[model samples]
Target: MKKTDIILLTGLIGSIIFSNFAGFEKKLDKIEHEVLRMHILANSDTEYDQNLKLKVRDKLLENSDEIFGGCENLEEMKIRANEKLDEINDIVLDVIHANGYNYTAQTQLVNMEFDAREYGDITMPAGKYDALRVTIGEAEGHNWWCVMYPPLCIPAAEKVESDEQAAEDYFEAEELDIMKNPDKYEVRFKCVELFRGLKEKLSK
Candidate 1:
């Protein structure tokens, strides 16, 4: 996403946060979680069949014990999670790519090694992905998810750059309707325009 595109989205998100402060927490949580998964999917370029993606993701979630040995608490669990994060990320990418899109699967979870999807186009920090799980597209549809500490991007700083705060501050998911098919608002419009501009630049 472009820098200007992010600011425009910021305006849209601002509206939701203000109007729906009452229902904001739950709403934001949903959006946050979805975006993380979506990010993987979007970048994965995996197969097009949603059913396949569902099956693979379900298996991963279900087999957590086999994939990860029993860990007692958050810290130990986190260590295990980080390891599986890479494997899970790879699995999802394989599913998506096999199904049929053209995306690059990126697994860096740090905030700094990140590039802004909406704004600064900046990179995030490099470390454990402790703060949030941010995927760009969901299996269900066109939206995204955000959450704290998803496994894949957690412990791979040696492998990747930072990924912190790489996205815009999102509004309540309900307000933006991002969980479902997001309406093509000004943000989408700007995205279209950005693509056009880039095309023109390339032509030049």
Candidate 2:
């Protein structure tokens, strides 16, 4: 199958579009927002983490082809979607560990708890904390999101997709104009949603 033909699990294509796309943005903008949200949502869930998610998602959208191109199959698609997420997780681990944070894979959550005082940080609890997330190939939206154990979960596949020949790209980027896109109407409506969100957020 072509790299463009990589299909997520039978039902998740919509969630990917809706959630990743942020549901109410223009086609191109939606893609950008969704990608950004992933980075934000994946973080250990702090203000900085959320902002970073938005930034990374935008970067991923700018290089949709690079991101999407890597998804030649189900496995590849998950990895493509998760590329930034994995990188961020690695960075978070390094910082936490350096500060004597415990990286315990208890039940697979990788609990990273530390003394805020040790890091000279404030407003954080003394309890153990870790990144909580829905694993790759497994987000189900209002639909059947597969199993739930810790932050990771399994994907539901009808038939396994064919193997992909390439890994995901991290930097290379190009864009297709959404105005002339095959789904122009969808893009138009989504754009309005994003505009409204911006207006509302800004007005507040």
Candidate 3:
């Protein structure tokens, strides 16, 4: 994702954190444990490598129907994804070689922190999330990430409904209301936005 897009998405996240402070910790606990993410890094920042990264992403998504389809919970998802690491690598290899490139791909399952991530109407809180990281060669390029288990971006990429119920899956009813209806809490949203903006500027 581009820098501008990140700021926009995280801004909405800041709004959530600001408005939902009372129950934020409880909400975060649920998110930290439930959300599963995927990140794909390119070989380099060059256009060719970046495009190759996306090609690999598409191939993985195309082949992921079964792996993600069978899993119901995070643990099951982790196990299923780990089992397919080799198969995922092979798919990436095929894409690279077919394109006359010589880069290699590696896949691993890990627990890591993720910034607030948005997919359409849903925004995940900034916290630790389980992930499948795919690095291509040097892996220094801008990355592409998505919610893997709930299949948020997958359906969007495939022109489907795109996991409209993702927030419900990860949040309690009260928190889901806060996420879906932020306008009802505008005061908190603005305060959070200002504080976050100031923090970013101070850090820079």
Candidate 4:
């Protein structure tokens, strides 16, 4: 190809790439804003601690209705969750004590960054999300996380057949398509994550 033709072709390709990334980023931003995440960190990686983590998760899930009941949207859920922070802490403490562990648990609301994560059939893209975070003891171990507002982790709590069904009620068709088909957007997701990482580093 001629020099002019080559330059034009390269510019065209760059524009196409930028356009696709912008579209993906916009959808991701919507998803991030509309969703609430639940993050629970274990006290340690010891087998006992890990088991305790699961127990804690179960207790929370069992009380999911109380924690999230009567919430219409993300903001309502956030307010209800905040109001119930004390109750949430008590629930965690009850689980820890019953499990014969004295680890202190702290629950709070925060905006936190998360990596791309898959739960059941849904794949959440990496981004910053508003989260209800629970830290146990030193909180140095692996963590468990899930979509809290949509009640994906606790289908029974929401009377849904599955997490995907619960998700469908909240996510738009295109957003659902993006999540249910992660392989289609793997490259775009990675690009966005890398861009965000670099941006965060630069900001710091």
* Predicted structure with the largest lDDT when compared to the true one: 4
Q: Local distance difference test, per candidate?
A: 0.41, 0.33, 0.76, 0.88
- What lDDT score goes with residue 30 in model 3? 66
Which 10 successive residues of model 4 have the least lDDT summed? 151-160
| Candidate 2 global TM-score | 0.21
Candidate 3: list runs displaced more than 4 Å: 1-22, 163-171, 178-204
Reference-based TM-score of each model: 0.32, 0.21, 0.73, 0.88
Q: Across residues 118-183, which tens digit of lDDT does each residue of candidate 2 receive?
A: 111101112233322322111221111111111011111212221110101211121222322324
Give me candidate 3's TM-score against the actual structure: 0.73
Better of 1 and 4 by lDDT: 4
Q: Supply the global lDDT for candidate 2.
A: 0.33
Task: After superposing candidate 4 on the true structure, give the runs of residues whose Cα lies further than 4 Å from its correct spot.
Answer: 1-12, 156-160, 201-204
In candidate 1, residue 72 scores what lDDT? 51
Candidates arranged by TM-score, highest first:
4, 3, 1, 2
Query: Once model 2 is optimally superposed onto the true structure by TM-score, how far is the C-alpha of residue 115 displaced, in angstroms?
Result: 35
For candidate 4, lDDT tens digit of each residue in 121-196? 7898878899999999999999988788876778844455787888899999999999899899889888887777
Candidate 1 on 1-204: residue-level lDDT in tens?
A: 999999999999987754554343334334333333223233234444445545445544455556555655445654565666677666656655676654344444432222223312222211123422324234344322223223333222223333332222333334344323333343543443454457679999
lDDT of 3 by residue, 1-204 (tens): 999999999999977776665354555556568667889989899999989989988988888876667687778889888888888788889999999999878988988877666667766655678889999999989999988766676776886664566555655776666556656655654554565568779999
lDDT value for candidate 1? 0.41
Which residue ranges in model 2 land beyond 4 Å of their true spot? Answer: 1-38, 41-91, 99-175, 179-187, 190-204
